[model samples]
Target: MSYHAIVIGSSAGGLHALKTIITGLDASFNIPVMIVQHMSPQSDNFMSRYLNQLSHLQIKEADEKEPIRQKHVYIAPPNFHLLIEEDKTLSLTVDEKVNYARPSIDVLFESAAYAYGKNLIGIVLTGANSDGSAGLKKIQEAGGLAIIQQPQTAEVSIMPQSAFDACPQAIVLSLEEIASFLNRLNNDTQSVAQPTST
Candidate 1:
């Protein structure tokens, strides 16, 4: 669908799945990815190191006011909410938790909605709570695409189930399927932009 950005949300059993997807993506993938993975404050820098090791793409624990860039994967810092700004940069805060998740998926999805609108692609993966449902819906409301991992295949089904119950149009598929879909989408976008030889 030619998305300019991808926003992903996950919790339980997400580390392996996320790594699998990111590692499968091409190194030059032009889409910027932002993620909100529910984590304890004690786990600070944990996901960063894990994902960095799993994928060649630049992966890091997001910092306050960090600028977003293509081909980079930005993970919300533990216990902080990550937001997208109008100018295409990232913002972080520790105001409060939504659905008991300080790095709430709703905050990232909603802010991404405002920042990228119709150009955004949202994905909800494994989790034990309903934190990402509202945010995924927000993305769709803003004319962005929404994807959810198949509940049956999810390590923890509550998150995807919530998304399913909330939005019937979401594309629910396995993690590998999602990656293949994104890879095609990225290539399709690039193809349309490249001028044919004269």
Candidate 2:
């Protein structure tokens, strides 16, 4: 399948997991990556700046109504929930938190599932809470690919474990393996024609 977009969620030990994944993606990686990594409301843009410096893809805090584009990593800003509109653009909301997070991972994944349907990839990485499980299931129900970091390898296993519990068919991989898999998907999309609508 020629996936159009990727949605990732993490918490607690997310910085390292995110960096490992982004570092493995070279400039040739073409899909837009939307991420929600739980952070304190007092947090600044330091995470974006750090990741941008380390990744080949541009990383920035997603802006309201911004058009989602390839070769960029858009991160949910602190104190807001980032969502994908039906038009494939981005919209940020300050609505009540889900899973105790303003930038809730479930919110992003659910919206992306609606926007991209089967052309979406939802990944649940290292995290401490059960926030991403329901959204990963939503992605699966929408026929999108679901990937979870192997619970054994996760710094905090609860999140990945919860996702696996919700969607047993999700591909479970280690951090390094996840990056390799994503790269392979990128290469496949580059060589193959976009899949025709069924």
Best by lDDT: 2
For model 2, the superposed segments whose C-alpha errors exceed 4 Å read 194-198
Q: What TM-score does prediction 2 earn?
A: 0.96
Look at candidate 1 and tell me the lDDT of residue 67: 87
Distance from true position, residue 127, model 1, in Å? 0.7
Poorest lDDT segment (10 consecutive residues) of candidate 1: 189-198
RMSD of 1: 1.1
Compared with the true structure, what per-residue lDDT tens digits does model 1 show for residues 77-162? 88889999989989989888898998999999999999999999999999999998999999999999999999999999999999
* Candidate 1, residue 188: lDDT: 82
What overall lDDT, based on C-alpha atoms, would model 2 receive against the true structure?
Answer: 0.95
TM-score against native, each model: 0.96, 0.96
Q: What does the lDDT read for residue 196 in candidate 2?
A: 57
Worst 10 residues of 2 by lDDT: 189-198
